[model samples]
Target chain A: MSFFYVDLSVNQSKTWEKLFFDLKGTKRYNKYCQDADFYNVFKQIILSLLLGEEIVLLDADFSEDEIKRLTANSIYETDDILVNKQLESIESKEDLFQHLRQINKEWQITLYTSGTTGLPKRISHSFQSITRFVKKSENHSSNVWGFAYNPTHMAGIQVFFQALLNGNPIVRLFGLSKEQIFESISEFAVTNISATPTFYRLLLPKFNQYPTVKRLTSGGEKFDEKTTNALKQIFPNAKITNVYASTEAGTLLASSGNNFFIKPEFKGLIKVIENELVIHKSLMGNSDIFSDEWYHTGDIVEIISQNPLNFHFISRKNEMINVGGYKVNPHEVEEAIREIDGVSDVRVFAKSNSVLGNIICSEVVINNDSLNESLIRNQLQTKLQEFKIPRLIKLADKISTTRTGKIKRN
Target chain B: MKKEKLLEIINTIKKNRNEVLINSIDETSDLRNDLGMESLDLAELTVRIEAEYDIDIFEDGIVNTIGEILNKLENKR
Candidate 1:
């Protein structure tokens, strides 16, 4: 079976045979820190998991400072533990599939949160928990995925496992331009696509309908009616599904439309406390941040019904700013602005607006006179999603701080 | 002169999004349809216009076209 498709100009598309050939020659690592292209990254994760090795997925675009913080200075270090897997003996594609099916239960995958509040936190998941929602049926074998998330993130991992377990081919669509994404969908005859609402928003003002796409899934962000209507127009044949998941919890609730209903099995595990959705510890990944039996998801939801417990996600708690209907983490925006060359410090907060509930505003302190509001906004456009970019940017001599020395939000 | 400044603000938001720029706009130009401005774009336009004219064009009601925005600014003056 085909493995994945990449840009032909950069590298040749790979197949299961190529993956097998590479697997035989590759040296295994107990704890791998992968920062590579989509193909190599996916290949490494598969190899590590099948061999029962721990792998830390790092974003390719993460700055060195971010990497140092996330890895705790162990960026280049690998464990010296002995791994006794005889992957080389596997000669055929069937053998490789057999090996993949029996994934090592001890294998752990670590992922970092977007660090919306502070430094990115480590969340480790067992192989079973990570693939909790994966469906492996004969009907799923022929589906092709339009991979559209950063491979390091939880959403990407979910899509990867779903496609991998079904032995389905995936087309690389993350970080690609709108035109490139459209081209890949048609060229690959992609049947299933799962991405954040932001990713689908980039394809807005629809021009063409992709008949080949049969299933469309949106998660990681709020799905609005305008976008849903636009997607319906663009992919007439596709059945749209919305998923509610988090770094703390894997895929849990899904709906064919806006409101999500908790499955009967998950009724006791998931609940809403004071409008905030909470998940029982059994459904979550291991993290130090979770201290209580019920992990407070920080996601506020509006209950639509009580009998079946159907609800719609409203907004995030505390520091999250609701801009229009999109949730923007102030700290995430602050982090992006702080990456600008001349930016010394920045404080991102929300300002009330008549047009969109709230508009993001930032007060930036710069080290150089050459940096201005427009220049910084232009730079931020590259690093952040459009909704996260501050609409009103004010250059300041210094950011006002509280007595605790934290940047003041008010 | 006010309309010119407003057009510049609209173009700035358009440029950031990599959308087609409009050379000229009249009172009949619909912000959402003709100018292709979304809610976020409208928010940016409000902030930029507020910065220039010290008025919230969308404070009283939702303005659909360039004419409505001009009327708001004219009333504020």
Candidate 2:
């Protein structure tokens, strides 16, 4: 095994030597697997390498049957593995490598897009693409990072590798509240932090106490004006940067001033065709998705000053409401509400909130006057996550549509 | 102004909001996570807290954790 790989599993007892031994013994993992790193980190990384297989990251809370059913039709159907089996199989492997040449250059993982507008799409990522932007240095050895994002997603994976590759300690923040997370960060002396703008908002109230946080990062949602200002006021000494990256396009741009300008080095990979930020196929993880040379990001950006690359993100092409950094697809919410018997036609959209960047709101055309707000809420609770469910549901006579006959989102 | 009275008022509000079960809340419990209270729910909570205590806890800023709310109420009185 190479020195690049580090064992940052839930248990610190799992060593790199043991990881190498486990990696060598593991067979081809062609089956569907959840990439949530709540347990053994080395096991999953090794399994991905040995098999050179793609791992889909579903919400960790997803049931075993749900995982099996989702991956049944995919290539991972035959030898699919669950969360527990993934760890056990790796720990059970014996043949350890003394010294390995290099990691697999092929695409190692498959990440699903947020699918805020529609159904989530599978995007392939290679080791090179994923680690392209991680600035690895021993200077970060003294720093302990807070693993805030869902480990299965792109941001989470980036933070994991950034700390692990440098042999830095990481404090897991999943299932922890804002207050608890702050306390953990303070207790652990966490120096580096990365999370979505919504996560930052939740942390703002208690942010002042964690003075040890030397680096701050925000992504996964639009790095809005309010958040940038707040972050500056809160963590004045910290080097703050809002990163712009997607599952399709691995890390793209960074904005220290809240106006994300395409970095000078990656200028060749970026293009602004007609207002939308289009990237060259080379920058994207899945190049095959692009029929043309450029992949459309669907995010509208305004170019302020060109030289060193200065641009500001306007808004998403589709009106996707980001609730506390979690992408809530309006269509999915509408579909869930539509399933309720009385709901005739529902148009779901985003309503801005001071704390949470956006909240899900719906205008519904109900058939029965007897159907009440609580009935709709009760029905939605069974189908959707609490964040995805609309905060306000109002009965409308009809849904307003544009000339194209599509429901108006704005 | 006692802690017990404040807890009672909070439990009643949490029960009515349907954000969380009354059995789940406690002094150390976070209002957002434990009660699943979003900004709107927090706003509703603020209204109830004000009505019960006759004090504007949120006049300073947003209060999230249950402990913070109790402290604010105690200090206000």
Candidate 3:
């Protein structure tokens, strides 16, 4: 157990310090925050629970309609936990530490994932399970981290805990524009950042210079080689690591280079069975899908070699496009399109068709005027089969992504 | 702009979306709520309708329902 203080502005600091004592916890709960005001209070409630209770984190957005559905279906009631109140109480740090010592050490948190293919699901993790990958050294305490995700999200909570656990300061990136993000980073002298590939892609052009960012991490989406190499050029001093993780599973694999390999000890814990990545039930926390010996992560992968085993992530099993009878992986097509000259980024999706069942549709972003429909189709015809070629292509100045930075395939 | 051709397009969209088609779809059918058509589904519907009718309904702006698409096709003719 650790006791720490968040360095907020004077007014908010006093408010949060009061919340540290007045806040309460429950057995299991669903947390939702509408905007930043709710987020500020919601985070403090989580902090109080982390110090003093055994709780389970439920999955759902902070939307009223979603809450209505969850309440109707699940055991949750809207009145079970309310957040509109002002918490004003105070206790000394020594007394807070005493209360923290009596709390359950095995208390767990469930991060609900908003997956691309279907409805969101809950992913459980203990404090140990989440902190397993975080660097335990005190040297990182001086680093100021930048935060961009919802505080309740896995990636977002990871940032908060990583900083709070190590006594570091975190600056929220919510509601900041492309320009404002860079400005705040410079203003705070943020030394570390962990965001989705989409976030970094948007920030690259706006980020003229930021000498303070030293440790960078990308997760919650596919990390491509092109973006990795570009970031390397920009953040010369930052040690960039791309990780492959899912809500069903915690941090499974990570690598700074071209490919991600299953960690040596986790070799048996994780395996690619019939091209689909599967993890031992021990890795996932309290999920119902783990009745079998291994939980099948629907993510697909390709094994590269044997002796020193290596593998590359493909696309999600559901995200694969079936044209007539032939299966076409979107990642394969996206990779082919990226190789073409002047093509900056591309998102390939399955466009439903009457005769073909589903046809390939691509949204291509180009930085230069050299790309056209015929030029792209001609280039892809050489690398891909005739059936795999995209039938509909839209040229756009930019590609849009989900909040977590994955290409919005839906 | 025959009703048969328009029904065929709606049915194709319904099938592609894996939604269960109740009755035969008509011009009055809601594309979003009734047919469960998303933005991606709407995009493909635009392409197929363009190919079949040789006129783009989305040329001017966004098209919402099956009725609006039929109106656009009729106006183009």
Candidate 4:
């Protein structure tokens, strides 16, 4: 278990530490990712866990020996070694203003996301923006929160960093599990839960079980009506909220409950041109992607409700798969796929096609092997638009994900 | 039986009907072809199905299994 030290009292010192064993002895838990090496990675993890080290800078382009060279420069109480992992990979050039900037009366969070390209895009958040979302739940209800996304992933990691930084407790199931989440809710008395629309679906079955939970928040990807309605019904006592933001942009747009009410406190300015969402660069506040005081949100939203706020998510621009002349947003088609039973994970992409110009393809990851390709395709026919359906569906042992819990889409 | 159940699940999800329609979905559908499901959605659905139906569809599965999933969900009812 990795632990970090936090000072609870000025006169005294405080440290938080815990040991975690893979509850699922699904032995493969230790089977490392192809992303990094075997030895140094574990070495770094052990040192960081045993010692109270918060940040470990990794240089992806650097050799392991080079990591050791940097480690020599690292001054920590623990013999923590640096691994060429996410901390290094999320690296982007820091703004020189970061040196000129003085932080006072506010907390700051540095955000790095896996954006449209596989590259990690970094953004900065003031205490007001990132933590403000978490604090918004103060007047809310919930018994437990499930924090399962990898911390290396910008969205999930923020949860990991903040849960401790804010003195909030959380539990992680081996993978995302409603059963495990329900168990944790009862076990830990958790009330507020945060997840991506994808992760929320994992725990969909457990909502009815938690009488104490009243707040459910989702981010990282699109949250559609089906998902919103499902969460509303499952946690009838809870409020379901969805936020639209990129790693480069943070906590930008939020919708509340089944009403999907947009929050009014957002200072960001938005414009929709040709069904695309655009933002004034100045609206980013302390964010990085808005260098010129304007940023284009590659998302589509409509002004659905005006009483309490401004807009609702309509669709996505990045999710668009160029299929010949027509641009197909993957999220638009993904909604149709979420209903099928026994299916675990799905991703849609466009492949060059001589006839259609580009044909859609999907990679499906499932635990059940009995259902074959035809059954799935037939099922798709019942729910999805024809062109949105995948031309081919390949079985994936596991869906490849960036450290940020987002599927790697090229 | 599988095809009928699969069709039912697809219909329920399409409506935004607050229900966990499929307790067990697998490779039988070209998930993209049959259900248009993505990898993250599939993973999340697997957990919800397991929790709602109280089924152990993950048994004998190292990653994700169609054979094992079918065997487990078949007797869930």
* The candidate that achieves the highest TM-score relative to the unseen native structure: 3
Candidates 2 and 4 compared: the better one by DockQ is 2
lDDT of 2: 0.64
Query: Chain B vs. true chain B: TM-score for each candidate?
Result: 0.95, 0.72, 0.79, 0.42
lDDT of 1 by residue, A252-325 (tens): 98899878999998988899999999999989999899888999888888999988898987666776788888
**TM-score on alpha carbons, each prediction:** 0.68, 0.58, 0.73, 0.57
Q: Over the stretch A230-253, how does candidate 4's per-residue lDDT look in tens digits?
A: 667766677776666555545555
Against the unseen true structure, what C-alpha lDDT does each candidate score?
A: 0.81, 0.64, 0.66, 0.50
Q: Show the lowest summed lDDT stretch of 10 residues, model 4 chain B.
A: B11-20
Across residues A279-303, which tens digit of lDDT does each residue of candidate 2 receive?
8888778734667788888887788
**By DockQ thresholds, what CAPRI class is model 1?**
acceptable
Model 4 docking tier (incorrect/acceptable/medium/high):
incorrect
Tell me, by lDDT, which candidate is best: 1
Segments in model 3 whose C-alpha atoms lie over 4 Å from true places: A1-42, A48-51, A54-62, A71-103, A306-309, A339-342, A369-371, A378-383, B1-48, B51-77
Q: Pick the candidate with the highest DockQ.
A: 1
Look at candidate 2 and give me any clashing residue pairs.
A31-A80
Interface RMSD values for all candidates: 1.7, 4.5, 10.6, 14.3
Candidate 1 lDDT by residue in tens digits, B1-77: 87898889998888767688889999999999998898899998998888888898888788999999998889887
TM-score of chain B of 4: 0.42
